[model samples]
Target: MTTHTPYGDDPSQYAELTLPDGAPRGVAVLVHGGFWKPEHDIEHAQPLVPSLVEAGWATWAIEYRRGTGAADTLADVRAAIAACPVEHPVRVAIGHSAGGHLAAWAATQQVGLTHVVSQAGVLDLRAAHDAGLGGGAVARFLGHPPGEADAGVDPIRQVPLAVPLWCVHGRADDVVPLAQSQAYVAAATAAGGAAELIEVAGDHFDVIDPASEAWARVLGLIEQLGRPAG
Candidate 1:
């Protein structure tokens, strides 16, 4: 672990970078999820980062302002990626829960992020809001109802994300629910984007635990990202 690097003047606009033992196979930008709330910081990413670094990938765990306006949150992501030290190519975004939403949304923009791994991301803002998940966290993040936000604000609206997006959703996840990943993959593939869903057994937090099989599954996905699909 290296010192925190600031992408912008704001305190929230920073990232923690970790290098691998040898040459990195790629770069991974980690986004933590706390249902887009201020209380949820980037520290929760610890469980997931080591696995990535041990896998021989340089990792950047970013922190952004939560519950802030949509644009502000997204600006943080774009800047963090831009500020990352380019130790290698094959830049990828790995976001969990609320972070999953950020990762998927990042791909819709010109953020230079080529691939995405959404772990139980709140991909569908409208659906999330409708289901009232996170106790109205979606509405709080939008600063308005989800219906009022632009189509681009929702990841589901931006299908065929112009990059490969793999969603790892826990079948037993009651937080974001497996439906989020299922619907996203359905929409993404239907729109011609390279999207996949890997169903695993566990709750929302299981996906982040390094000791869990879910993390093992994620490691496999990272390996696949470095290789050209045959």
Candidate 2:
């Protein structure tokens, strides 16, 4: 995998690796989940990059500042998307865990991101905070308690655009729980947006285990979303 930091000024900050293909369907940005904390780095997503490259889709795995400034992660995402070849036909944003929340936010801020996929993502920040998942490092990223941010930045409160939304969750997930994705699907549907919620056998980590069936399901969703531009 070739490494190039889109924002070279940031140093070896966020590295991107694009699959080598003559005519690719499009590109997918895989946002790794770490609850927007410093402990979980982008290296955690390295294993899944090859699988995406094999599928004829280019993938960009991003790294950003976590914690209270984590809200700025969207800026890094926009930079990554802008760094890609403008001719790519389709573009999809995919993320796991906390990254899912960021992906959803990115979709709202930018145009041309035709699809979004959240894998066992923490979609409802308010719910997460209430469930005690938003404390500590998470609280720092959110910059507020669950009760306060619930009305503003919560994915559940956002109005999704016409872009196709896919939410995948493990039936056995205990970290973020399946309810996170369930809540998001409900909100997207209520907003008159197209959203699909898929359930698979596994837990939070198992779903993204790469070798697990759930990972395959995620890849399938990406292929469907990253259709040839035309």
Candidate 3:
């Protein structure tokens, strides 16, 4: 795992997992989420790095500013992608939990992205806050009341960036809830965005458990996106 310091004043950091071969099929940037709390960083997704690399894709394990004190993780994600070698186009953004929300947001900022894979993503920030997920780190990340989070940063309310979005959630996830992904799909589709929803069997962390069958299913989504669009 090769680490790279972001090109800004922020203390944000990131790392990369390159394929053994010379050129990569594409780049997959993994964004971790602990409801945007400072306690959880990108390292949470480290276990899943080899999953993409083994599939011929280079991976960038991202550690963006988490709390309200630092820059928005959304901005950090954009900077990290911008810093990536232009030659290796960003094939997709795979974000888990809050990172999933960020990935969905990042997909809108770029034009050539293959797609966005949201793993247990937060489609409605306000909903999470309202449901009391925002009491701790989540509240700091969103910088507002639960109602504000629902009405303000809701991914559904934002303009669709026109990239294909695949939202996956564990049918039994209690922390982020499966309904979040469903709501996001509904909003994305209503906004004319390309969206796909998959209900896998697992809990919050199990969704990223590389050993679980659910992990393989998520990678399948990435592989399908890597192929040339018809």
Candidate with the greatest TM-score versus the true structure: 1
The residue pairs found clashing in candidate 1 are: none
For 1-230, candidate 2 gives per-residue lDDT tens digits of 55665553553247576675666677777788888877887777778888888888877777775553754665666666566554675878788898888787778766467788888888887678778873554567756566753454567778665687889899999888899899889888988988889999989887668899998998887766566656
Candidate 2 TM-score over all chains jointly: 0.90
Provide the lDDT at 158 for model 2: 81
TM-score sort, best first: 1, 2, 3
Candidate 3, which segments miss by more than 4 Å at Cα? 1-5, 69-71, 134-138, 146-152, 227-230
Over 1-230, each residue of candidate 1 has an lDDT whose tens digit, in order, gives 66688888888988998887767788888999998898999988866788788887888899987777877898888778778876455889999999999998888777678899999999999999999999999888888878844678799998878899999999999989899999999999999989999999999999999999998998898897663212
Rank all candidate structures by their lDDT, best first, as comma-separated numbers.
1, 2, 3
Candidate 2 displacement at residue 215 in angstroms:
0.9
User: How well is each residue in 1-230 modelled by candidate 3, as lDDT tens digits?
Assistant: 45464656767645454553455667887889888887888778888888777787777777777765424666777777666653554478888988888887777666345678899998876677667764554567655454533443457677464788888899999888898999889887877888989999999888889998778888887776553212
User: What is the clash tally of candidate 2?
Assistant: 2
Higher-scoring candidate on TM-score, 1 or 3: 1
Give all candidates' CA lDDT scores.
0.87, 0.75, 0.74
